[model samples]
Target chain A: MDRRKYLELFLNESREHLEGAGKQIEILISGGTGKNATLKEFYRNLHSLKGMCAAMEFRGLTELLHAMEELLEWGRAGNSSRLLKTVGTLETGLEEVGALLGLVENGDPDPSSRTGVLKNLRSRKKSRKIDHESRRPRNSGGPSEKPEVSFPSSIRVQMESLDRLLESTAEVVIHRLRLQRSLPPASGGPPGNHQENLRQSIDRLRAEVMEIRLVPFGSIAGRLRDAALDLAKRREKRIEMEILGTEISIDRSTLERLLDPLFHLIRNCVDHGIEPRQERLRAGKKSVGRLLLLVTRIGSELRVELRDDGRGIDPALLKDRAVEGGWLTPQAADRLGKEEILRLVTLPGVSTHREPDEVSGRGVGMDVVATRIRALGGTLDIDSWPGRGTAFRMQFPLTLAILDSLLVQGKSGTYVFPLHQIESIQEVPVGELERGRNRCLRWKGAPNVDLYSLDEILGVGENPHRKGTCPVLFLRTDGSRRGLLVGSILGRRDLVLRPLGSPLETMREFSGAAILDDGGIALLLNARTLLPETPGPH
Target chain B: MTKNVLIVDDTRFIRTMLRDLLQSSGRYRIAAEATNGREAVDQYKSVAPDLVLMDIVMPEMDGIQATVEILREDPSATIVMCSAMGQEALVVEAIHAGAKDFILKPFTEERILTVLRKVLIPQAASPKGSSN
Candidate 1:
């Protein structure tokens, strides 16, 4: 019931929804009328995200996205050039929301950061401008009558309820914790009495509080499907977007935050994945391109898989690009695996288009999508078969509010790693660690990895242990693998994740902070951040 | 024979460029120049110029209003409206306001001459009683 935790979730989710709307609208603009349905979908999605943000009591995000949704709605109803310009406005709004979201996720979100976009949207007043200028009379009547762009009766919600609920829940949690601690220890009572009852009730209450943050997946997926239709039409290609698992429940904030990556993957599939009708016909396939988006749950994680049946990736082409970009030599490129080729497509500024075109395949967008996904502690995988099709799979947690972490003791203090990122922990004998330039450990039958000291990493050292068996946590980041050295492993448990303020947030290694049962702040270290920065090809 | 020309525009850079271009030819001499349409009408009356190059979107009365006023003073006077791509409809309306022709911007020397030659020569060469 921590307010900061809820706020972090809300900010993150709102960002995702805003990004999704931007990507969809941009595609609709580039693809033209064939993307009309997608344009409407984008407008509706913005409205929906706004509604959800309002329900979550994120007033700033709600206000911003609401105004943005109105603008998009006005744009969707207009013709080609108008829609393109409107989408540009949408991008500006999205950028403002993105900057604000970064602030909120780090705590201390600046509400005034987005006044310019809001002011611009309000003053633009598409309907009034169109009506007044178009219908102004030359003779007796003074000015032209403009068509009034009206906001629909819906999209508004009561924020007071969410605020009240947050306050009451926080009070109840504090009270319950106080009462539990006050209970007498080791009293000659049955094991399943008052304490067990209290624990059961607390668990149920915590579950209910978490459930309040869950948003329906359908709202996010609806806009992506619409965008695919619009993009396909514009490209003169047939793309069918089939959404699976639309009713799944994810933290409303997570659903919103996940939109940019999800929408990009869908747009990429339609724009770059599917070939034109003539190409499809020449390839001896149906004219209609098939794009499937399957959002399914795998244990505690949700997998958003977007698969397309068009022209798949050519490893040879990717290899050529890598060699051309000097990322690798011809010999090294030939030795590269299939997955490596797919990874190249996600590299910043690497587009598949030999010549830049307004439409997709000019790959500047996917890098942003990859970064957003990574920021949310998600992993994106690309699988492609030449002449077949390409499928992008992104797996992420359903909740950012709560994280299961492995708390570890270091020289400085106790630090936590999200359990998913910890590949394995091994008690390596001190003798096995060969001292080198920067704590490199060479284990039998394993690659040599750099040893990262938790205290050294956090910049707070109190001598964790000079001589003892050190526990090594192996982590994988973007394909680069590394090991972290912690003084002691403290098992795993679920903790309510809270964002750290800007002062301490400069520490990129730590994602955020969480409060332990003893009321001490634990640093939640992002495993990927722990990896040493690899030097780019010179 | 040298013809008198009136130049109307908001930007000093553009007015200077047009004045230099027209005067450099030695066949045309600048009658007067105005920054806005309101001033343009006053200049047009003072000079009674043979031709006028007018900008459409200027402060203190647009070119269309000045064109109407200039035509009201003398129906024989020729005024060409300067416009950009986004202001095509406004250019059409300016033509209906009794302007003779339009020159698009950012101006090239060739385009300016073509529009100017068409607007000035055709009307000047026509029989005095012929209806346009």
Candidate 2:
């Protein structure tokens, strides 16, 4: 067998196992009590990883894992202090192994590298052993119970195969629709029954294929638990993390892309959101802080809410910071409401920490997290109460590849509006349309809905008004509600969205393009971009 | 008649390499491969190969426990321990659990063949193979 063919498989598997071991190590360091069962499990993972590195001829990595296994054995023997000291060394060694693996994947398998890590491990092991021998007379007792290990039954499948399966399913649905359209009006015939039956079966198959791409949220949440443990230990803070809805599933690619942003959020929670032990006690609260991550399915979106029970963001401080940083004039800052001021924390270079720390304040701002979540077609909202807590709510579409959209025709071209953003479709008489600085439509004693011409907003020229009545889509987001005018309503569709490339990607008004049944492209409108900034009074 | 062999290790790359080496020798037939010791024990009962090549440390159950279980079921099962450097203690433990012979990893093809001959082709094998 060619070794090169297995290089990618080797790299991916190695990285996963290494991450698992690193997480376990983090738990152990954060006062895990070095339970014999946990130590044994950690040792086994390291041992297996060492064998893999050896098979791949990565001598440096194999040596590092070997040392880690030894240190784990000492930890198993009830040497907590010595084990704590070795955790930093092990972490640095793990990082080196990751870098060396990257180099090996690029056709440069340098086995002699990481000599410094090997020497560090060797010296640490010798010194620790000497200390162990000197203190051996006082050691006593061994673990009485061993934990049983169970592995989940799973196999790796290439992502391309999954995408191809979904694409073919979509193609089948498209062809089936075309066939159904071509059929003549059925006069109570068996052919029509067969066509309907075929359509139903095709729909079921498409749904099953879509479910294949769904991965449970636990896959990433497990890693986040480890990260939180590490950060809490480094900051010397006591935090209890409660993760709910790990059973809920999200698109695998979406979960993978969310890892970095979620990591930043968790780190921020530990570093900034949670008050220290002394501060909490002084405030008549429990010494240990609480951080909660809750995932709930809301219609077609997954709403992830992260809440921390600590000193919340002070809106006054945020306003001051905004003014001091010249992000807003003092008068402008004073005019902003508390909720708006709280949102300034997401601005670039806006950090509340008085001094930079090793864990969370490395100069990277929270704006990166907000921008990334937006790029995934999601929205982030912050809610904070002065002395109560802060909660961040992020809602994302279940999958980026397919969406339920309402198709509407404009003056220049047809467009797609995500169905989740539309509250209702109503026809208002053209004579009742009210215009001032912004168009408005008032109906049935309801509040005035800010209206905009979809054609005008899309730079497709002014829309020619219908003679008697006009159709408008009632758009409702969490913060505001508005209306969009279209030439004609063309019903709903399940669209397979393809991202715009190059020059077209610069268009902020459109999110992506979808292919219509007639083989024409329909640009999908971004509802958030079209909504008015402020809600009108009722 | 070719000897049927079961290879057990947690790493896929190592399993593939061993399968290639053993099949190319023409004297051994690859029966199956298992990633962990639990799977190794289950595969042993199903395949019932003439020889088993087992790694010392694995997730779920180590090779020693797997060897003990298999030998309890069939005392005559031929098993060889595959260990890494600096695991002499584990090699001895595995031997006590009824492994027939042992070979250190990163071993050369000649060394592997010699160990196999010592364990399988006992009468034709030279006494020099028993040095370990």
Candidate 3:
């Protein structure tokens, strides 16, 4: 194989590492906190670059990266002040790497011949270390804050997705050619099968494309764990993070947008919520703090419960902070209940931390977290017990473009409910229904659940189930279960849920409109909107 | 029939080199190429290739983790670990993870073929015309 052929691939992949490290260096120079995490990322990139350059036998690149790594590792071990002083040298070293790569790119078979850059870096590193050895070191940062992470965080357009698209295209082409023929279609012949093949192919293509847009939570779990471990190490706190439902995958865009907010939450817990090891032990708790990122699907929504067993936020502190920050008067702060006061964390400029530091708990990012979640069409709720812990539960709308929905007949016409939310469809006799203002329902060998008419909720038309019976669709939300009465259970469909634009979007009862096969449209009901929080009959 | 092979490496250079070496021998077919271990596992499951040439220290689940995952799913899977010099420790870990044989980076055509042949057909890599 030609070495130059490898050069392009080598350059593309290796440049990514170099660029990633260079970006971290820029952040460090800009006085970014999480300096430990930044340096860890820097070292990781260099280590990766070393491995690659070594394989390619690019001695100059290897030597430069190796020297840079030694200096970075030393600086990460509690000499950030020294690192601050060497930013120029580090920047020059990075530029030297770029220059070396440029030489390789220009077909220099022996880029190793130019060893001037490596020598300069080594000489400078020696002098800097000797100059810094006399001064007492400050905080001895953890060896490596972020442990080596090994999981693909982003979804790639791989052969599988491409293959599916190709197969679907081939199917459509074959069907088109078949339709072009004048011969009548054969009932069971391979030569002239129905358009079902095209339909099946199209459906498969839609599904494959959606899957491409969704990434398994486990993909990003590696970094989340890394961040948690990094913070725990830097803070010198013992924390165990358990991430459940790794199998649950969400929209790629939503996942990407969430990384920062999730990081902020983790930082908040570590900085403010979690007590140190000795503090935890003194509080009669386990020496190590426990954190859980539990994701579960409730009805049609995804609920992510982030819970940490640590020193939970004290509402009194929040009250004081709210008053001191002038966001709320002392009387107004006192008027808030425990839950309301805790929610003040999501209010801008309301932080209970004694002092603000890097990462979070400066009363800045929590509000941003809330705003971001809201922008994603999600809700955030926090509750904490001072000595116990804090639990934050975020609910996200099922924003997948393709929604599996259950179509039901109503007096207004037909509507669709997200199939995942519908627990069971039961035909309830009129006598079985405790009808009136507050309708209640009972089913054979099932727990009694409150039932309301779909018409009453939508006010689209008169009730169609006043006579004989109705099909009650059971739904389970977070901490509650209820059933809604519809004309009847029509069927199920894989709906291409199109968001209602502008004027109609204001109607929160319907999230998106599902265009039916026969020029008909079914409003995909938002289950959250329909649950009007009537006191639970249970 | 040419043995189906899946080349796994983030560095396209290594992947391309391995592909050329394996295909030039005319004994292996390139079933797929994955840039990382997660993709490797996915490709392995989907393509079910006869052999895998895996590189360690790549991003998002390195060869050792990918090897463990693949072997766990299919105990009989045949995987060949690839490492640069000074990654012998990683190679040992990969071997313990059930990779059959190993190859070094800056690959020599003969070396890769020998390792692939040995792993693919233990008795085939004989003193005679086995490599061919």
Q: Chain A TM-score of each model, in the order shown?
A: 0.55, 0.63, 0.51
Please rank every candidate by TM-score, starting with the best.
2, 1, 3
- Give residue A20's error in model 2 in angstroms: 52
RMSD of each: 32.4, 22.3, 20.0
Encode model 3's per-residue lDDT on A271-292: one tens digit a residue: 7889999999999999988889
Error of 1 at A30 (Å): 74
Q: Every model's DockQ, to 2 decimals?
A: 0.01, 0.26, 0.24
By DockQ, is 1 or 3 better? 3
DockQ of 2: 0.26
Query: Best candidate per TM-score, number?
Result: 2
Prediction 2 TM-score vs. true:
0.52
Give each model a TM-score: 0.46, 0.52, 0.44
Q: How many clashing pairs in candidate 3?
A: 3
Residue-pair clashes per candidate, as listed? 14, 0, 3
lDDT, each prediction: 0.68, 0.74, 0.72
lDDT of 2 by residue, A204-318 (tens): 6877887989999988887898888778888899988989999999988888878888888888888888888999899898988898999998878888989999888888877
Top candidate (lDDT): 2
Candidate 1 local lDDT, A108-225, one digit each (tens): 5434342345545544453332222222212221112222433221233234454355446555555555565566663533332446545656666767866766667887776887
> In candidate 2 chain A, what residue range of length 10 has the lowest lDDT sum?
A144-153
Ranking by lDDT: 2, 3, 1
